[model samples]
Target chain A: MGAPFNYDVLDLTDEQVDAEVRVFGALTAAVRRLNEATLRTTVDHATVEEVRRQVEELTARLEKSMIPDNFGVSFTKGGRIRGYGNAVVGIRNPNAVPLTVVQDKVNGRASAEFELNALHEGPPGQVHGGVVALVLDQVFGEAAAAGGSPGMTGTLTLRYRLNTPLGPCSAEAWVDRRDGIKTIVKGELRRADGTVTVTAEGIFILPRWAREEIAKNGGTPPQFE
Target chain B: MGAPFNYDVLDLTDEQVDAEVRVFGALTAAVRRLNEATLRTTVDHATVEEVRRQVEELTARLEKSMIPDNFGVSFTKGGRIRGYGNAVVGIRNPNAVPLTVVQDKVNGRASAEFELNALHEGPPGQVHGGVVALVLDQVFGEAAAAGGSPGMTGTLTLRYRLNTPLGPCSAEAWVDRRDGIKTIVKGELRRADGTVTVTAEGIFILPRWAREEIAKNGGTPPQFE
Candidate 1:
């Protein structure tokens, strides 16, 4: 038989990967718009039922393009994709906003930035509290990863300093302290004005999955999938 | 003029409330089904456009009704209806779930339970990890409320001991310790088999809003909302 249907076959150019990321973001924005319109209307059984039906149809249309059934992870001769499974825009997941996370060795620090859309709202005219925590967990985990331990967040503690508006925001994380599996990472999500709305401390664990996966890949960690 | 329209004045018999809860559960399940099918289908652009049109029509029809509009909290004189709002039923919110929290006589013991439907998925066959934390935070806050603090979560931490399966699950909480303003609480979410999928600890603070609300209410702690 021919070589297995590996991700290597679909070697995408850097430009193509960039385009994929953009498409995912646009689609997420569209979904958020639809959601807002639906919520702003009157509430009733019919409204509920109709929204459900319409959402069903929209979903069917969106997934028409069959990406590989496997999870988002890739390793090739070129480079590795990091922080690819973010719910909004991900290279491996066409459905999320595959955010590109980077660690700047020049500064020996980790930072990330991404745009938020309507799909992430919790209260009226505000982003969901949990989404803020999710991003914080990811950013903090990135910091932990910098120290050679990619992990799953074991405990994440967040204070909703304020109502985080839905729009462009940046997150930064730095290793504050470490005690074996208990890594204390401090992270913040800030607005364009540099006002911080969310702050977090997370304790992440070097789960068995990540440890084994790293060893199997010859020390090349498949970016957070 | 009639009292300003209070959004909290509808009443149902215990049986009626239970029935509404059941319907709410079913509708949430349908939303999930819609999400999964949408993610897996391969419809053409033209078909998707057509579906969008149908959705608009459904939206119009649903808006014509008023039940979901008239849903929310309610209080009345005697057993009869004085004012009424939808109390966790009436699909006014796609993401809404009814939480019933009961505080114990002891200073820091409390318990809560609620149902999750399709609108709360993260991974393929599991409850979204963030949602798990959301539920935990709310319950732990409720437990702190047991001590009559009526505080907000300053720092909430969760451990994903295992993947929480999609279906009926029970969660519980109790006071762990107290240090002045910070009331530490612990809780867990479990499947029917008693396997704890998630556990949490929270630091709750007696926020300014709560303190003021309590004082204005004649020092009697407000019941769970």
Candidate 2:
């Protein structure tokens, strides 16, 4: 059987991919600003209403022509990924926490430095526990990939040790070990000054389809989360 | 000894609260539309840049005068809640999954009917696993609150039995049992057709601060996640 979904490995030039990254990246940043302003604004009702109308008009202009559905992860002939709809690190997703993970393939590690804001609050001024899990899941997946063995998250466990303040934060993860098809990942969420607030462990495994594909092609599958 | 955060019990009348809800809810919906368009649109680079400028201008209008930080959960004299910054079910939060959970206060049950679109995608057409955890965490927190034992999420575990497609979905959670200071909530994520795709159990606990407040003031803390 084939993989559960269709992923197109397209042929595109580096120049084209670079331009798309630049253009869409800027739009995503702008939308993120809009998201933050939407929460903190103390503007009056009339201003809010007027701004809503303007926002709708701009959205319509962009939506004139669009993809049929979500931006499925696509691979370029050059091996660049266009997983632009990812919730945690999608470049085009304004809902993301604006995380950019750096992979250390030699060390089987992944790390990110990001900021959380008013929109990410859970208990008063603290980051939402769910958001913390979301970011860690991504970092863990990247760590598994950095180790050259990747799969979907089968089980993720988190222990909340301390409250993470809503501001500058960092996350680091590394591949702990592997057992057959399963890769174990360990990681933590930290404050800017480097105090650990949460710790996590995740089990990642190749789904049946990926395993079957490997049996047939003897090729490793792309990293997925 | 204070509740770890300042919560103002305001004197806003019903009319004022209702109006704020209506106005802010509309803005949140509009921003959601913009978020989707940002990912799906196929407009040209010039058009994308133009839209970004327009979006930035409109956002500035909203940000002219704003709250210093997050919209912390507050209670009115009439008991209306102002938790507009919440990540899961916040009406004023565009990044929320747009969920409206129905609480069966009598039976310790809570459920929500919402939609997950392109922005929530992870594996091709399926919803992100972290997003699933995010939604279940909120519903489970609500279930604990409905049981008359509000608390924060101590730990959450999710097992992915199947992939949840991106579209209309439902979630239901109930208080499975309770121990001293802990509530165990069980729930599942289902397709619109009612097939369970993800099963979850969460442990909710009254934190030290909340416990101290309950001891001194002889009152239960509000539900937090």
Please give the distance, in angstroms, between residue A157's alpha carbon in candidate 2 and its true position after superposition: 1.3
Worst 10 residues of 2 chain B by lDDT: B216-225
Worst 10 residues of 1 chain B by lDDT: B81-90
Query: Native-vs-model 2 lDDT?
Result: 0.85
RMSD of each: 7.1, 2.7
TM-score of chain A of 2: 0.93
Candidate 1 lDDT over A109-188, as tens digits, reads: 46777865443443323454556665666567667777555566667778766555567888888777778776677878
Give lDDT for model 1. Answer: 0.54
Compute fnat per model. Answer: 0.19, 0.73
Docking class of 2: medium
Off by over 4 Å in 1: A1-27, A43-48, A56-105, A108-131, A145-149, A159-170, A177-183, A189-198, A213-220, B1-32, B38-131, B145-149, B159-170, B177-182, B190-193, B209-224
The window of 10 residues in a row where model 2 chain A has the poorest summed lDDT is A1-10
lDDT of 2 by residue, A1-225 (tens): 124356787899989999999999999999999998998899999999999999999989989989987887888899888898899889999898878999999998999999998888777677888888888888988899898887777887777777787889999999999999889999999999999988988887767754674566555576753
Q: Please report the candidate that would top lDDT against the real structure.
A: 2
For B51-119, candidate 1 gives per-residue lDDT tens digits of: 545545654554454333223224432333211111121232333344555678576776655655433
